[model samples]
Target: MKCEYDKDTESLKIELSEEIDMSTCKTLRNIMDGYIIKYSPKECVLDLEKVNFMDSSGLGLIMGRYNLIKMMNSKMTILNPGDYIKKILGMTELAKDVKII
Candidate 1:
């Protein structure tokens, strides 16, 4: 995962790749959490265009970030997730807290 922060826009965008599973979720979570705590962006976006697979741990990551940003009165969005990811997200309560576009 790669994270970019735009100070002018107050946006933090996370680029996720390949898979978000046990092997990568911890690193992904650390990267995302650290960025959020440091920048506290007004907008946080998870870009899932390159992710082909994700497990329940990925859902936890998504939900945790959603809650974190929400508590800070910020917005969190998920972008470019494929159909599979969309279906996974749709089945979860995390969808209620995250905006996917």
Candidate 2:
């Protein structure tokens, strides 16, 4: 997985290119936390368009970020998720939590 943070928009855009499994989850979490704290953006965008697969761990990441951003009076958005990821998001009932635009 590759992550990038845009300090200007306060948007942490994570480009997940592979499966979001246990091993990658740790790296992702660490990177995301760093960006969130460094930029302190009012919004976050997770770009899942390149992601092929994701498990519950991925869901947990999204939820965690959502909670963190909420506390800061910010917002989180998921952008261009593939079909598989979309299903998982829907099943997890997070469609409304993030924008899919």
Candidate 3:
């Protein structure tokens, strides 16, 4: 995950690539949490344009971050998730909490 805080937007933009599976999600989650805690951006933007594959762990990561963002009175946005990831999210209720673009 590549994280940067945009002061203009007060958004912490995170760029993710490769696979978000069990093996990588753990590290991804930790890194994301650290960024969230550090920046506390009003909008947490997750860029998944480079992510080729995702599993349940990826969905879990989104949900976990959404909850954290909400607790901080912020919001979460998901960008460029692949079709398969969109399908998985559509099948569940996770989409309700996140704005996907």
lDDT string for model 3 (34-74, tens) is 99999989999999999989989888888898889999999
Candidate 1 lDDT over 1-101, as tens digits, reads 78899989999998998588888888888888999999999999999999888978888889888989999999999999888888889998888878899
lDDT of each: 0.89, 0.79, 0.89
Candidate 2 residue-wise lDDT, 1-101, digit = tens: 56677767767776767688887888888878777777778888888888777898988988887888888888888888778778888886677767877
The weakest ten consecutive residues by lDDT in model 3 span 89-98
- Sort every candidate by lDDT, greatest first: 3, 1, 2
| Candidate 2 weakest ten by summed lDDT | 1-10
TM-score of 1: 0.93
Which regions in candidate 1 have their CA more than 4 angstroms from the true location? none
Stretches of model 2 off by over 4 angstroms after superposition = 1-8
> How well does each candidate superpose onto the true structure, as a TM-score?
0.93, 0.85, 0.94
Q: Which candidate is the best by TM-score?
A: 3
Error of 2 at 57 (Å): 1.2
